[model samples]
Target: MKRTALSAAILLATSPALADTPNTDDAQTLETVQVTASRIAQTVDETLASVTIIDREEIERLQPQQFTDLLEGRAGIETSQNSAFGKTSSVYTRGTSSDHTLLLIDGVRMGSATTGGASWQFLPPEEIERVEIVRGPRTSIYGSDAIGGVVQVFTREGRKGPPKVDAFVGGGSFNTWETGVGVAGGTENTNYSLSVSHFETDGINVQDGVGDEDRDGYDNTSLATKVSHRLDNGIEVFGSILYSEGESEFDSTEGDDYTDYVHAAIRAGLRLRLTDRWDTELSVSHSRDENDRYTDGSFASQYDTKRDSVDWLNEIFLTDHLLLTAGLDAREDRIDVDDPGFLGAEEYAETSRYNVGGFGILQADLGRHLLEGSLRYDDNEQFGSKTTGQMAWGIQVAEAWRLRASYGTAFKAPTFNELYHPDIGFFRGNPDLDPEESETFELGARYSVEPGYLDVSIFETRVDNLIAGFAPPENVEEARIRGLEIEGGYERGQWLSRASLTLLDAEDRETGNELPRRSPVTARFDLDRQFQRFSAGGSVIAKSRSYNDRNNDIRLSGYGLVNLRASYQIAPEWQLQASVKNVFDKDYETALGYNQPGRAAFVKLRYQQR
Candidate 1:
C-alpha cells in the first residue's frame, strides 16, 4: 500500500505545518500545486479534489525509514502493518479496500497483478522526491483500482545547478541501521540524477501466539536514476528508473517463513509542443513485483507479476479560461505463480490479460465559478467493456471562502489470481466473480488567510459486489462509508503547527457491522520550532477502537503515541539529528495479534552541498 500530494484542500490533509518548510515544488499558496486530481497541473484555487503533498524536504525532515512513517495517521488514510520492519503493509484510503486504492510512480501504475497491491516496504524513501495523495473516486481518469483514491510518487530528479551531493547515515533500535547517497546536476539543456540506499533491521516477532516466535529480520537495498534533455526544437525527452529488492521474515499459523522481494519501475517519455495551443506527451512504462516464499528454509511458492503500458496524452487550449484534454492508455498484466506441488497438476486458466481505455476531460473557468467534467470507456479482455464518468463544481462564495461539490462513479475488476488461479489445497479462484462498482458524492469548504488555513470535507461512498475472502473468493458483499475530515494549520515566523481529524462510519451493508481494521476516529497534531542553527519538533497520533473481524467478535483497542525530534546544524553543509518514536511505549495493534514496536530511538548524520 502506498502514496498521494498538495494543493487549499491540502493544508488540512497533509498539514504541511507538520511536514517541513515549503520548497519551490510545495509552496503554501493557492496558486501552486501539481496535483493528480485532474492531470492538468491546476492551481490549488482551481482544483475541486482534496489533495495532500509531501515533498523531499518534508521526507527528510521526518526521517522516515518505512512507507508507514510517510503516510500513517493522516486524514483520510488508515494503515495497517504486520511488523515494525518490512513485512506486509496496507493502506486504506477513505475506508476503501486495499486493492481499491491505486499506487503510481511518476504517472505509471506499479504493483502486483496477483495481489492487486504494491509491495510498499521495498520502496526506499531515499529515492523519492515527492508524494501526492488524492482522495475520492477517479475511475473516469485512471480506469480501475481508483475507486478509493490515488497515491502518486515522484522520484528525485536533477536540479538546475552545479553538481550537488546529499548523503545520510543513521541507526536505531532493533539493531537497525541505514545509509544513502545521492548526486544531481543539470545544465540549461540536460539534467541527470542517481541515488543509492541500504537498510537492515532486526525486526520483532509477528506471530505473537502462533507457531513461530523467533525475531523476524529485514534487509533492503535500492537504486534510482533519472535523466532528461531539451532539444532546440522545444521537445523534451526523459527517462527514469527505480529498483528495490529486499528480504523479509514473518510468522504464520503454519510456521516461520521468509520472502524475497523485488519491486521496480521503468519509464521513458517524450513531451512535445506541436502547435501554439496544443501539447502532448507519449510515454511507455514497465513495472515488476515478484515475491519468493521460503518455509523452513525451502522454496514453497513464487509470484512474479509484470505490467507493461503505454500512454498518449494531449491537451488543447481553446480559450484563456477553457481547456480540453484527451488520453489513451493500454496496459497488459501477466502473472506467473508456482506452488510447487501444492496446487496439484492444474495450471492457471488465464495467465495474462490486457486493457485499453480512452478518456476526455473538459474544464471551464468563469471568474468566481469553475466547472469540470470527465468521461472514460474501457475494454478488458476478460471483463468486456465498461464506462465511467464524473462532474465537479466549485465557486468562490466570498473573498476568503470557497466551496465545492462532486459526484463520481468508479469500478475495479478482479485480479488474475482471484479469477484464474488453479485450485490449491488452501485456496481456489472464483471464475464467476464480478467487478466491483461504486459511486461517491462529496462536499467541501475552505478558508484561508496569509498565515493560516482551514478546510473541511464530507463524503459518502457506496460499493457493490464487494469481494469476500472465503476459499474461492466471491463478490457477494456490499459496503457503505461516510466520513468527515478537518485540517488546519498556522505558521508564525519560527513556529509551525498543524492538526487534522477524521470521523468515519464504515460498515458492511449486509451485516451492518463495522469494517475490519478501520478506526472510527483518528487525529494527529504536529508542532515544530526553528532557531538560528537548531530545530525541534514533536507529533501525536491517536485513533479510536476498531474491529478485527467482520463479525465484530474481535476488538482492537485504541491507543495514542507521542514522538519527538531534534536537529542541530553542524556546519553550512552538515547536520545532526536525533528522534524518539512511541515515546511512552504504548501497547497497540493496528492488526490483530501482531507485535508493534515499543519506545525506540535513532540518531543520524546528514550532509548536503548548498
Candidate 2:
C-alpha cells in the first residue's frame, strides 16, 4: 500500500511540528521583501497576505519537469491537468475560478486575452529563478483577475562579476529528453544573463474511450534573457525577454488532432531617485499568445491574442515609520480569430478593448503594530467604472507569535472569447456579460523560531456575477468559498521537512452544490536529509474525493502519491541527479476523463562553473 508516505504526512500533521520553506532556506524570510502582494516591496513579516517563496535552489532541488509541478497543493492551491505534460491545465487558488488568479512575469501581467488564463505548460521552468505565491485577494493593489490571488514568476537575475556558465541534460520515462545551458556576467554598473533550453517527449494516450490509440507527443524550444544598468546619479534601466514555441498532440476524438503555439513576453523599465525621500518608476510591457490548430495534418483554425501595458508608480516616505504610494495602470487587449462573423457581422469580429486604473496605498509601522490601507478605481471599456479597497492590521501577540486580519475586494473582467468570440458552430458569444466581483475576509496567526515556522489562515470569499458556460456563456451564477490552510517547515541538523494541509467548503450558491473539482481535504509533506556531498528526499501528496460536475453526482475518488529524489556530487562543480515519481504507481485522476502519468523515472547530469 501507499502507507509509508501517507503515514509520514499524518505524523507530521499530528506532531505539532512544521510549512514555508525549510529553515535552511527560509531562516531569512522575515528580511526578504516581496512586491506582488502590496504592489510595493515589503518585508515578509509586514505583508498581511499569506505568501510563499520558491527560489532557484529549491527549484533545482525539486527536479520538476513542468512549471506547474512546482505549484501543486501548496497552501490553498490545487491543479488539475487535462492529460500529462504539455496539455491544458487548470490551477485553482482557494476554491476560486482558474482565471480568477493572475499570473505575472517579472512584474508584467501575462496570459491569454482570449482564453483568460495563462498557458502554464509553455512557460519554461528552466528560465525561472524564483516564484512568489500570495494567497487571498489583492485587487485593491493589482486590479482585475486578482479575485483568487497572484503568482509571479521572476527570471534569473544577472550578477556583477566574472562570467559563469551552467548546463544540464536529462531524460526519463515516456521517451522524454531535456537540456539547457546558461551564462551570466557583467561590469560593476551593468549585468546580463541569458539562457536557452529544449524539451520533447512521446507522451501518453491522454484519454479513455479515445478514437486515436497512438501516444500523443510534445516538443518545445525556449529562451530567456535580462539586462540591467545603473547610472552614477542613482538612475537605473532594465529590460527582459522570454519566448517559447511548442507543438503538442492530444486526444480530441477527431483523429490526428494537434496544435502549434508561440508565446512571448517583453518588458523594459526606468527607475529614478527624484529625491532622497521620494522615488519614481515607469515601465512598459507586451505579451502575445498564439495557437494554430490542425487535424489530419491540415490547418483548421488560428487564435492570436496580444496585450500591451504601461504603468507609473511613485513612493514617498512621509515619516520615519509611515509611507505613501500611488500608481497608474493602463492596458489594451486585442485578439484575431480565423472564423465566421460574430452576430452576423461581415467576418470574424476583429475585437479589442482597453482598461485604465488608478490606485493609492498608505502604510504605518508603529513598533509592534502595523497597519495598511489601499484603494483603487478601474474603468473598463465595457464594464464602465468600478472601485475596490482593502484594510489590514497586524500585531505581535507574543514574543514568538503574531496575529493579523484583513478584508479585501476584487474583480475579474470578461475574457475576449467570452465577450466577442466568432461563430464556432456549436456556441455563440455573449457580449453583454458583466464582470465577476468578489469580497474576502481573512484572519491569520503565525509562530516562528530559529529552526522552523508555522502559520494558519482562515478565509471566506463570496463571489457575485460568476460567468458560467451555457448555450452561451452568462453571468447568472454565484459562489461562496470558506477554507482553512495550515503550512509549516522545519530544518534541524541534517534533516529538513515541510508540510501543508487545506480544508475547503466551496459551494455554488445557485445550485446548492459543491464547486466542481474542488477537493474537501488535501495535504502534502516533504522530507530531505543531506549527508556531505550526497542528499536524498521524498514527498507525499494526498487528497480527498471531489466532484467532476457542479451537481456533485459524479465522484472522483481520493488518492495518494509518493515521489523520491537523490543527488550525488561527482566533483567540485559537477553533480548527478535522479528521481522516481509516483513510486507506488497509484491509479488516480485529478480530472474525470484525463489520464494521469504514472511510475516515471529520470536522471540528470549537471555542470557549473564556480
Candidate 3:
C-alpha cells in the first residue's frame, strides 16, 4: 500500500499539466549547479556521483534547529547524539565510522585534529546558504578522510539585486530563544553579504538516571561575511569568513562536565580565465577549532587545532565533449593540548604534521554516455605516501532514464590524539598506527520526469586496517558494509514532497558482529503545501534498531518521529512561522543511556526588505 501511494503521487506529479509548469523555488531542477561533487561547477544531471543539495530556500522552509537535525534523515546518513540539543553528535555515512566522513566550509576543511570530527553542535544553520552532500569515496578530490563521503557547506552569498536586509527572532521549547539578521546585495561585478546570529536554550536533563537533574543549558554566537568582485578581463577575487563561539553542558561519569568552544575559518581565492577553454583558481585558507572543558566549574583541559592550506587548480576544455582538471594542495595541521591533570604533564602536548597532494580528473560527455576518472597522490609527514583513484560511468538508457556505476578508494589519517596522547591506564595513543583505507563500488539508476525524479543505488564498501580502541589505538579491526538507498522528490503547482529510505548491513569482519551505532534501516518522508502567502508542511523519520557497543551488547530500540511546520506572510515584509517536533512524544535514544528530547514547540517572526 505504501509503495502504491508513493507511485500514485509520482504519477500525478508527472501529469501533462504539472510537467509543463516552470521550476519554482519549491522544486528540484535538473539544471541546478553543483561544485562539491567534482570540485568544479556542473549541472546535477552532468555529475556521475550520487549527490544531494539542500539550498537556502529549503533551509528556511525546514528551519532545522541544529546541524544534526538538518542531516538526520538524509539518504546514506545516520546521526547519533548523546542527548538533546547542543550535545556531542556524530554522523556516519554509508554505514562507515563517524570519522570516515569529511566536513568542509566553503571548501576549507573544518574539524578538530584531536577529536577526528567536526563540532556539529556549534555550526549554526543561519550561517549557511547551501549544503552539498556527495555520497561516495572522493579521495581523488579530497586527499584523506573521504572514505564514506564528503559534505561541503557553502556560506551565505550576495544575490544580484538591490540591497536588502532580513531578520528573524524566535523562541521554542526548553526555554530556547533565537535571533539573526543579515544584509546582502550585488551589482554586475561586485557582491557582498554579512550576517550575525545568537541562540540559547535551557535544555533537558542529559543524565536522567545519574542523579544530576539540573537543566543543561547552551548558548552560541555566530558571524559570517562574504564578498566577491569580478573584473571585465575574466578575473575574480573573493574572500569569506565564518566564526562561532559557544558553550554547552553535558553529563560525565566522573564530574559535571561542560565545554566552551570557538571555531573560525577564513578563505580567499582568485579565479582567472586565461582563455575561453582554460581557467584556473588559486586559493588559500586557515581554520581553527579550540575547546576548553570544565569539570565542576573549573577548567580541566584544553585542546586547540589549527590548519592552513593552499591549492592551485586548473581546468581545460580539450574539446566540446572532453574536459580535464588538475590541482595541487598543501596543508599543515598543528595541535596544542593542555591536560595537566589528565595526562600528568609527561606526554607530548603539542604536535604538527604536513601533507602535500596532487590530483587530476578527466571527464568525457558523448552522446548518451558520460565517463569520469580521477587520480591523486599524497605525501604525508606521518603516513608517508599513498595513492587513490576512482572511475565512474553513466549511460542515458532512455529519454528520462540513466544507469551509472562507480568504483573508488579512500583513506583516513590518524588524529593527533589517536597518535600521540599519553597512556593513562584506561586510554592511550599509539604512535605506530597506520592510516585506515577502504574500497567502494556502487551501481545506481535514475528516472526523471517533468516535475519529479527518482534515484536508487546499491553499494558495498570493505575497509582494512580499521582503527579500534585498545587503550592505544590499533589496526585490529575490519568492516564490510553494504547498503541500498532510494530517494525521490516531486514538486508541482502548490505541492511538494520528498522521500528517502536506506537499508544497511554493516559487520565487523573480525568477530562477525554488527558494527556499533549503525542502524539496519532508516526512512524519511516530507510533504508541503503552499497557498498564496501561507504554507504548511510535515515530516516523518523512522530508524531501525542498532547496537551501541561493538560486541552488540547494548541495544538501542528503533523509533519514529513526526514534525509539523507552518508559515504565514503577514505583509510584504513580515511573516510568522511555527513548528512542533516529536508530535507523538515518542521516547527513544540515538545512543545508550542518553535521554532524547520529547515534544517541542517553537514560534518565530521574520522581516525582510523587498
Q: Which candidate is the best by lDDT?
A: 3
lDDT of 3 at 554: 93
Q: Give the alpha carbon lDDT tens digit for every residue of 386-477 in model 1.
A: 99999999999997788999999999999877888777756778878889999999999988665777878999999999988748898889
| RMSD (Å) per prediction | 4.5, 7.4, 6.5
lDDT of each: 0.82, 0.82, 0.84
lDDT of 2 by residue, 35-106 (tens): 677766555566788987777778888899888788887899988888888888888999998999988887
Q: Mark the regions of model 1 whose C-alpha exceeds 4 Å error after superposition.
A: 1-27, 253-256
As for candidate 1, its clashing pairs are 3-151, 4-132, 4-133, 5-52, 5-53, 5-132, 5-133, 6-52, 6-53
Clashes of 2: 3
- What TM-score would every model get versus the actual structure? 0.94, 0.94, 0.94
lDDT of 3: 0.84
Residue 340 lDDT, candidate 2, scale 0-100: 28
* Candidate 2 ranges with C-alpha deviation above 4 Å: 1-28, 253-255, 340-350, 423-426
TM-score quality measure for candidate 3: 0.94
